[model samples]
Target: MNARGYFWRTVQQQEVDYIEDADGIIKGYEIKWNPKLKLKAPKSFKEAYNTDVALINKDNFREFL
Candidate 1:
């Protein structure tokens, strides 16, 4: 994943599991295979990006994937 700080900060030095572009567009996926698996989108994700995050977890894997 690619991330950049706002307010004229230099390029970020860490990698993330997700990424959002300058226009706040994000790109990625999450997959849960176990029948009892549970997952939630991160708060930072919604706070920093645009577009709804997609969840590909066990409860609705087929329909989502």
Candidate 2:
């Protein structure tokens, strides 16, 4: 299925690097260069949209690609 989506950036400067509409389900992702950093999805994005959020860092990026 072809998915349509975009990055969610807010006035407060919080951002989700990518948001994808996979069929009817939503998915959110945050990319961080630091593999040790533990990051969560922006609060506004999570509260506004129902999605599975994940942090993609140097260590586990291969899975996404």
Candidate 3:
């Protein structure tokens, strides 16, 4: 299946850096420069979608790939 990428942000400023839509399945991503920084999917976004958001950093970015 083909995938399309998009960026999402709400008027209130909640955001997900990247979103991948593969057919009807959705995936969310947030890129971080520092591995130690705590990153998580926004609460509003998680409440709306059943998908998990990945926090990508140098140490473990390849694992997601």
Ranking by TM-score, best first? 3, 2, 1
Model 1 lowest lDDT segment of ten: 6-15
Q: For candidate 1, lDDT tens digit of each residue in 1-65?
A: 55543321115432233433544545544455665645455555455544445556566867843
lDDT (CA) per prediction: 0.47, 0.85, 0.89
**Model 2 poorest ten-residue lDDT run:** 43-52
**Clashing residue pairs in candidate 2, if any?**
none
Q: Judging by TM-score, tell me the better candidate of 1 and 2.
A: 2
Instruction: State each candidate's clash count.
Output: 0, 0, 0
- Please write out the lDDT profile of model 2 over residues 1-65, one tens digit for every residue: 98987888899888899888888788898889898887877877888885558999888899988
Q: How are the candidates ranked when ordered by lDDT, highest leading?
A: 3, 2, 1
Q: Scored by Cα lDDT, where does model 1 land?
A: 0.47
TM-score of every candidate relative to the true structure = 0.39, 0.83, 0.87
Write model 3 residue lDDT over 1-65, tens digit each, in one string.
Answer: 99999999999888999999999898999999799988877988777878789899999889877
Taking all chains together, the TM-score of candidate 1 against the true structure is 0.39
Error of 3 at 60 (Å): 2.1
Write down the RMSD of candidate 2 (Cα, Å): 1.4
lDDT of 2: 0.85
Give the lDDT of residue 26 in candidate 3.
89
